[model samples]
Target chain A: MAPMSFAGKTIELDADGNLANRGDWSDDLARELAAQDGIAELTPQHWAVINFMRTVFEKDGDAPSIRRLTKESGVDTKMLYALFPKGPAKRAAKIAGLPKPKGCI
Target chain B: MTQTAEPIQKVSIIVSRGSLEGVYPGLIMANGARMEGIEASLFFTFFGLDAIIKKRMNSLKVATVGNPGMHMPTILGAIPGMSAFATSMMKKEIEKLDIPPIGEFITMIHDAGCEIYACKATVDMFHLKKDDFCEEVDGVISVGQFYEKAAGAQIIFT
Candidate 1:
């Protein structure tokens, strides 16, 4: 139940969407994540973007816009959808180890 | 406590053919991953092995009529000159999307940092050497080594 980093906090996944890293959360975001299923992976591409998104968040604590993401990674947009099969921003975000994105559903 | 999870940030795809149909999926996926900000890899093996063959990778073809679609693969095969027609059609569709030809796309993806692998066993099976492959390949690897790299990441057989 302890936070993974130097910070001392624990994220519990028992709730619908308890973040795996509560230390990474803002209070409001933590509560929101708790309201959904923890996180799910329906395909390989989901895992692909989720991993990349985590890196961006780690560097900035904020999710990159899709355009920024493409520019940064140099991958095409259509392919992201091909992998996710579920919407990219909405679904891939959860598995990527990020807080609920601001203004994102 | 939430599950103790590992963080993953990159992806690898395996491409083993130089043919139009066999190689494009891996290239498309690699490019797609790059677009998503994920590091993508393509490992080429066997006849798919041709996808990385420096001279042949770019010249792959769609199997037209005799492909698994039952009636199509053979019917297309029966037509004397239809193979070229099918290849051109495939090329047109890909061009419409602006996807480069198989060779160029592979090069682009590799330059974008998509790790490309040429299987050693397959190379031996086909009697090829590293120089026989395109520059995109990072190294020749065994299936075991491939597993080591692919462990925490997605393993796409395409």
Candidate 2:
């Protein structure tokens, strides 16, 4: 695990850079993490996905897969890719402060 | 001897088992590889061909024999309906998580740009036709063709 510095506060990140503790996550943290991943800012659509992912993770105890994301998040597959690029589920989970999504590969 | 490093950009997965648990690991790996921006190809042969056969793909079973996960004595595993019970149990669990059925997963993998190939030798031996396969199957190819296509890619047999 590595430490991420934001607002003079040190936060822990998993080896893959996801938040080490979901309870430590906040909206500002997500914004910082998203920017770290190269996104300039989080848009409303991005918030929709981030919130949806966090909600699902809180209930399911695991991040949702891309299949589940598209089917349940109200965000279609194409837009998901466009919004997150590269790997949507993985990026979204990281930004949402959840564990890496299952079945991402 | 020093080995030169060559970036791996693709993975070739060979699926030769027919059980539900056996078939899924390959799909999971292939899907994972693709998510990492790597190209993935799944070559199905022998009993693995059941994964692409429309009528059988959704009906794959978990083998109780030799499966420590079964948690039952090996002799009891030979009882009829045990496989069906196991399959149904697995299916229910998967469905609860909203995972797509095997057929849909195959299509999803293909749509994700992973090439799905049927082994020609097995196709001939089983007298299977293209129509017998699910739409996700790109084509049937000989072992030589698969070898050529798999050239330079990491090969995994499951």
Best by TM-score: 2
lDDT digits (tens) for residues A49-69 of candidate 1: 655777778887866655455
lDDT by residue for model 2 (A17-105), tens: 88888878899988988988888899998998999999888897887777877778888755776687656777888999997876543
Quality of candidate 2 docking, DockQ: 0.31
Best by lDDT: 2
User: DockQ of each candidate's interface versus the true one?
Assistant: 0.04, 0.31
- What are the Cα lDDT values of the candidates? 0.63, 0.85
Highest DockQ: give the candidate number.
Answer: 2
Sliding window of 10 residues with minimal summed lDDT for model 1 chain B: B1-10
* Count of residue pairs whose backbone atoms collide, per candidate: 21, 2
TM-score for each candidate, following the candidate numbering: 0.56, 0.76
- Model 2 agreement with the true structure over B63-148: per-residue lDDT tens digits: 98889988999998989999889889998987776667889888777766789999999999999999999988989999999999
